[model samples]
Every structure is written in structure tokens, then in C-alpha cells.
Target: MSGSRIDFRKAKFLISAPDIAHLDEHLPGDVGVEIAFAGRSNAGKSSALNQLTEQKGLARTSKTPGRTQLINVFELDEHRRLVDLPGYGFAKVPLTLKKKWQQALGQYLQERSCLSGVVVLMDIRHPLKDLDMQMIEWAVESDIPVLALLTKADKLAQSARMKMVNEVRKHLADFGDAVKVEPFSSLKGIGKSKVLGILDEWCKPQWLMDTLEQAEEE
Candidate 1:
């Protein structure tokens, strides 16, 4: 059977809050795979995570931007974690606090060795804002695998959505084709296959394979 067919059924909500690393600490220590989602406020990050996991209310949703002020972690299994990062941009907060939040997020993204990949969610209409670019640049510099989810596809016409996808790809080309960019809508169930397929690949625990391969090489 095709690996893409593998079912990533929804798991229980392990925890919730604003701190990313603190939430990570509450996670299973033996976690072998992790895929984190990051995006701006109201970019549908929580909704996309909920849809992908096939679990409603896995992550809290709010009409208010920046409601998710901390990094939320959802443990998928004994060995996997799906993280929901705080939204950036137009958070309507103090400048100093914003910088602090950004720094915390940056530290996690750049330093988390356990992170397998990052799912960067972008609103279909406004995909690459300045803050979005910063996050993308950080991921690029860290050499982390990233998949762009062009969310809210249903809000646009079919042709317009495709154009937006191409534009996002063009903007991200500097990061390399490994940065998978695709249109998606949790409401419409579009791009579900693409997202899940990418997750399946990242969930493979390549570090473990490499460890075994190296031992054999020795």
C-alpha cells in the first residue's frame, strides 16, 4: 500500500498554553518525530491543525488575533508531536512583549534539534508579509524542512487560488523546492492529501534510521 494512505488519526490534546518549550517539556521524552505549525494571528493555524489531526478542539480558536500567545504542543503518539506556534503580525500588543515572543519563538525554531519539520501556514490572499518572511528566513537559515499551507483557499476563486499558490512558490523559491507550497482549506478539505503526505514523510524518524545505518557502517 502507498505510504500516503497511512492514516494519521486524531490523538488526544496533551496540553495547551502560550509557552512553546515549556509545553515541549510536558511532552513525551522519547518523541522521535515532530512537525510544528507557525503562522500569523487568524491565519487559521489552529483550524488547520485541528483538521489535519481529524480532531476538533485540539487547539483553541479565536476571532481575536494573537490569542495563542504561546506555543501549543499536541502529542500525536508515543513518538510524535504536532506543535502550534503563537501567531505573529498585528497581534495588537506591546512592542517589547512582541519582541520577547518573537525571540522565544526564534530560539525554539533555531535550536530545537528534535524538530523534524515546520508547516508554515499562510493566508491565501496575503501569503508573504514581512513577519512571515522573517520566520521563513529563520527556517531557511536553520536548514529545517518547511511546508507552506496556503490556507483559506475556499475564500478565493479557483483560478485566483492557483495564481496565489504560484506566487507563494515564487516568493519561497529562494528557500529551495524542498519547501513544499500548496493551497489548502480545512473547510473545503482541499490539500488534505498533500499535507498528510508530507507529514507521513517527516514522521518517518530518519534520525533513527541514520543511527542504525551508521552503526552498520561502523
Candidate 2:
């Protein structure tokens, strides 16, 4: 995260996993940190991920919802990762498959030791649904930090966008202090900076801790 900017043009395909056992093969132990992008099927999660990484076709944008069915992993470097989690709440898949996804996702969020945080995306027009709240609350319950992005802010007027952002922030306050909500638009590149800033912070190198310690001693 410190050596160079997070250019998704440089993001190589790591792997896609249907379960945690496969994910563990690539990112074992606490050697690296992952920030996951998760949301409902039509929330524009893939688009937001591509915009942040600066790659157009990196995550595949499609009109047909529920195109992504696995945990897609992309690496910024050896130390940092951006994970595109399967969208929830409306995939045309079978009930058994849907249940499988939910169980796997729950395990990944709660048990993945190196998972640093989660970036939850929701459409600005429909900010906080029960499913969205459940997702955010799940991460909070796991003691994982969450950044909720109100995607597609470009569709709304500035006043409406700000109002939604405020309302989201206030409602998430019920979850915990770790929850943060912001307005984002991938098409217009709105809030990309904030997303990147959080990634860089989470993926900050281990050496920075030494510098802080020395400064404190001085």
C-alpha cells in the first residue's frame, strides 16, 4: 500500500474460491491483509471495486444481476488484497446454492484471521435495507471495521445524496463506532479517494509501527 498507488491495472488475478479452504491456500496466516467489497446483487459492488483499482473490466460489469458466484481475489501486492465477495439478496440461483454462499460468507467474515475490514456497498437510492443492516451488523459483531459506501450517488441530486449519506451514518451508529458510511459513485468517480485512503490505511506496512514507536520515545 505504501510503495505505489493502488492501480488495478497492476492487480493480477490471484484466485477465486467457493470456500475458505481454497482462500487459505493463497493467503495463509497473517502475512497479508484483505479488504472485502460486499453488497446486494444490484448494489454496484463490482463497479465500485473496478473504479477504486482503476481497471475498467477487472471485475466485469453486467446488467444481469448475480453474475459473481465466487470469492474473487485480486492482489495489489504481496501484502495487500482486495476481495470481491459474491453479492447477496437476489441471485437467480437455487435455494441450496444460496444457502451455501451465505454459510461460506459467514465463515469467511467471522473466521478469516487476516481480514482487516469490509467495504459494504449499497445503492444510494435505496441506502439501508434489512439485508444491508444484517451484513453491516455481522461485520461489527466480528469486531471487524466496516465502511459502507452509498454507490450510484450520481443518480441523485446533491441535496438528496447528502441527506441519504447522513441518514445512513446515523442509522449505522446503532451498530457500533466502527461503522462508517459515505456516498460513492463509480461512474462519476465520486468517493474513490476515500475508498483508496481506507485501503492504504488498512494495508499500511508493518514498518510504520517502528517509526511511531521511536517518535513516541523521543
Q: Model 1, 54-107: lDDT tens per residue?
A: 877887888887856787777666667787777777457899989877877777
> How close to the true structure is residue 10 of candidate 2, measured as C-alpha lDDT?
76
Q: What is the TM-score (0 to 1) of candidate 2?
A: 0.88
lDDT at residue 88 of model 2 (Cα atoms): 86
Estimate the overall C-alpha local distance difference test score of candidate 1. 0.78
For every candidate, C-alpha RMSD to the true structure in Å? 3.4, 3.7
Error of 2 at 50 (Å): 0.9
> Of the candidates shown, which would achieve the greatest lDDT relative to the real structure?
2
> Model 2: C-alpha RMSD to truth?
3.7
Give every collision pair in model 2.
none
> What TM-score against the true fold does each predicted structure earn?
0.87, 0.88
User: Model 2 segments beyond 4 Å from truth?
Assistant: 1-9, 28-30, 205-218
lDDT of 2 by residue, 147-176 (tens): 998999999999989998998888777776
